[model samples]
Target: MLSASEASIEAELKTKGLNAPRLTPADIDAAIVGEDFHVFPGTTMTVCALKLRNGFVVIGESAAASPENFDASIGRRIARDNARNRIWELEGYRLRSLLAANA
Candidate 1:
């Protein structure tokens, strides 16, 4: 797996991504500046917060109906993935807006 800051990855992404006329994984990845996670006390609830470059925050949640099924690692990953999915929609809209403005 390539780290996000690698020049080769960024170069390739910029070259191919700009002309695609749609949101790309690189685009979404680029927008994320920070991530935070939390679990509610005495509950099987997990929360993930993604901080974007523009200072906007998106949140995602995961909960287990039963304590027996709750796993810390799994819950955190699920919550983070849920938050990551929202970034796609937000980035898609941003891409669309940019496209519209340039048209």
Candidate 2:
């Protein structure tokens, strides 16, 4: 399910007549075959590596200003989000290329 903001954007898109193929959440999940995360030793830095189905890897990082203020959960979440953001662009490009080819 899309978040409220996303839903709103989707609705607006429909109103403006943008019915072209889009990169949905399911597409992102389907593209990702494996995921791994790491938190650096003695630091608040976290990194997430997402492996796509085509063997490409996308990496994302998160870091807290002070180790004392860092939470592993938050760091991992943020890092994963950053990684996922990259997938959107990659997948979008793939979709566009396929569309152009078929045009």
Candidate 3:
């Protein structure tokens, strides 16, 4: 891991035009489960990311549903899955492994 400082991460994100909102751990927890979102009648799972002071990004997402609602549920799953998949991809894992594990 690069282990860069939070300030550096913030700077880098800013340079990339990502407006990372400053949030406390509790805030992060709340955001994870869709607290930061408006209630959608057909809402399923919500997912988001948190940038830590240690330069590591913590991913927060809702879990799978029992009787899935394809649109929202799949959206949530894709959001969470994409974050994790990108990490493994960035670490040099082959796309085949990524797809296999996701299956």
Clashes of each: 0, 0, 0
RMSD of 1: 5.0
Q: Write the per-residue lDDT of candidate 2 for residues 23-93, one digit (tens) a residue.
A: 77767878889989999898888999999999999999999998788999999889988998899899999
What candidate 1 gets wrong by more than 4 Å, as runs, is: 1-19
What tens digits encode model 1's per-residue C-alpha lDDT throughout 1-103?
A: 1346556755787787655676656677788899999999999999999999999999989999999999999999889888888987888888789989999
Off by over 4 Å in 2: 1-4, 11-17
State which candidate has the highest TM-score.
2
Ranking by TM-score: 2, 1, 3
TM-score, every prediction: 0.78, 0.84, 0.27
User: How many clashes show up in model 1?
Assistant: 0
Residue-wise C-alpha lDDT for candidate 3, range 25-53, written one tens digit per residue: 23323333221221235555566454433
Q: What is candidate 3's TM-score against the reference?
A: 0.27
| C-alpha lDDT (0 to 100) for residue 44 of candidate 3 | 55
